[model samples]
Target: MSSTTRTTCQSECLCDCNRPGAACQDPRFVGGGDGITFYFHGKKGQDFCIVSDSNLRINARFIGKRNQNMKRDFTWVQSLGILFDTHNLFIGAKNTSIWEDSNDRLSLGFNGEPIHLLDGEGTKWESMTSPSVTITRLLDTNSVEVEVEGNFKIKATVVPITEKDSRVHNYGITQEDCFSHLDLSFKFYALSGQVNGVLGQTYASNYVSKVKMGVVMPVLGGEKEFSSSSLFGTDCAVARFSGQFTEGNSLENLEYGNLNCSSGMNGRGVVCKR
Candidate 1:
């Protein structure tokens, strides 16, 4: 039997993009292969769920800073949400880091940088979720592949006026401050416990008018994470999907099943089943 249902967020839930993506796509998905998007209003101490592939698989809300009056402030809060879960797969942002986990059913922790900012501003906000992501399924087998791309633009300068030196006062920062933007892209393919690849790029532009570039691509030599001996071989199926997002944008992909892999999954040294 197949079932289709949709639940409007009672309030703003986390998945990142202010608009909806992923889950609301079609009919009778019943938790089929799809991902969710999320967004924030820049509130301090706000609590919302970052939508992921499944309700049980999303991220906690990105917390904002509190004011000297002990009130939650929105200005510097980290905006997070937007994630993907394929078959038994899971990918997300937790705390200040990005991570990938499976059915082991972990509590969901943050990995990598949580928020990306304009760059040269004296204060440093932690890394946030990537700008956009895309996932695609391989032909025949349940194995899947994903491509996540994004840009992080950090402000280069911050000037706040305060009467005294207080902890709350120290966190004050504004968008008018100097800025920098880092363009980034990441890609990963997982099958079982063996992962075939990982890639990332960081583009930096400082107010000093200096531009620095860095690239992190797949290291040809490494131990595989999704090997035949890994649980993915016997316990899980894989899918593929991908999409793009702007900074402070949240959206989900409800089209995992919509991908056509009849030509077979793309890539060498990788085998897929239909």
Candidate 2:
């Protein structure tokens, strides 16, 4: 362990490696151009605060990986992933069938209109405000598109990959700890005043699941959607996006094509079809 203890063990994995103070994984700046990043999840790895940034980006996980597959984690029965927000995308899932609906399925998109909040949709849209995420436009809306599953007809964009430009914290997010206590509560967002939750907003603290824990998000990196691929192919293709061109957030001139992802019995998502 030379070279100054290997740069103090990657600055103690960006400050504070034994779990203490001042090393919340280093990027705590939070302003325009954005900051805040932390991860070390799954299987008793603990420490979470996925992200909250400018142009918006967050992850508990829908994070996929199939090509060059050295490693990647966190899909956690789908729970609390705020989305690549620029024009809007919010997701939360976890109700595989506690007799069909034990309540925990909130999916969203406004500029690409497709909001599905299963389990009584929060008591029929209790607090989704912004006229309940309203945005409507279609004159063939440039001939709307959707198609997925290897025959990937892609016009794909999943916005907000922050952390001063993430690569997924250069391999430091492992996944585990949705035993519930993120204190994530979002209401009425169309642009919820440009939500600077750093990347996904769950900033409340006083965690007590594993007997006292503290880590205030910083040092995150993770790739996105298509290019840098995390190709999903188990339940197969169902990509969804509604409408946003002149300004939805980020994603300009994206295109890819190959088709065969319109399945039956309704049990697949991430769809795009025309």
Candidate 3:
């Protein structure tokens, strides 16, 4: 994903002309690839989400300074947040550090609702009901993977970035939002014909061409948000499905790889049939 993104981003940015080769700022992908693309360099103290075709938006936001009174400095990650139709879930984690975790089920909801982070036999997290998915932590690493079983998988890794404190902030870092971002990767196990999000919206489009440049950049000129939480990116998220989120949880793929998330029994909210 990074390789393809680099090639594509270089082709289209405001700093480029029809010239053969030149370097521009790091690219922020708003659309591309197998129904998936993410702005891994999410601003610190600013809220954002990595949207999927499931009409689902997953947010690992940071909360530190208010947008009205902010600076161009690094902000701490205060929560692991989630958003669906409306409701939000924020799990508490280390606010000072970006590469760590807090504990089991320390979270709150936007609607003041109660949410739980069920530990799946010490492997991953399975707590959502509708449009079920699994959150798996990569062992011996500072990253987590979210998967809709045989449907799709997303991995978000926090990479420590440092500079000489120059005023120039690339990777979408501006005065109000200058902090760490993510090293993101995505792979789909099975294609859910119905989809949403940037990738899903432009997966194989004729009107929106990736070769043209600006066509792929996600146009999100709207209000932004933020949260703070632990290492479990999508695992410790709050889900509000208008429909009943039910399925059988077999959890066959316990490691960090492609999984065959098949259902043998049916129930609501991460049900595992034994």
Across 1-274, the per-residue lDDT of candidate 3 in tens digits comes to 1111111222221222111111112213323332112222345455543333233444444433223433332333344444433444444332222222222223333334554435333366654554465555553233455555454455443332232222232223233323333434444443233322322333322314223322332223212222224222332122222322224322222123222222211110011111
Report residue 221 deviation for candidate 3 (angstroms): 5.1
Q: Using lDDT, give the best candidate's number.
A: 3
TM-score of each: 0.21, 0.24, 0.40
- Output the better candidate (1/2) by lDDT: 2
Residue ranges of candidate 1 with Cα displaced over 4 Å:
1-47, 52-56, 60-63, 75-171, 174-274
In candidate 1, what are the lDDT values of residues 1-274, reduced to their tens digit?
0111111211211121111121111000011111111111223333233221111112222233445774534232122232333222233222312111221111112333222222221322221343243233221111122333321111111111121212233544333321111111121222112111110101001101111112111111111211112212221121111322222212222123222212211111111111
RMSD after Cα superposition, model 3: 14.7
Error of 3 at 272 (Å): 41
Error of 2 at 253 (Å): 5.9
Assess the local accuracy of residue 129 in candidate 3 as a C-alpha lDDT between 0 and 100: 55
Shift in Å, residue 33, candidate 2: 22
Candidate 1 residue 169 C-alpha distance from true site, Å: 12
Write down the worst ten-residue block by lDDT for model 3: 265-274
In candidate 3 the C-alpha lDDT for residue 173 amounts to: 29
> What lDDT does model 2 reach?
0.24
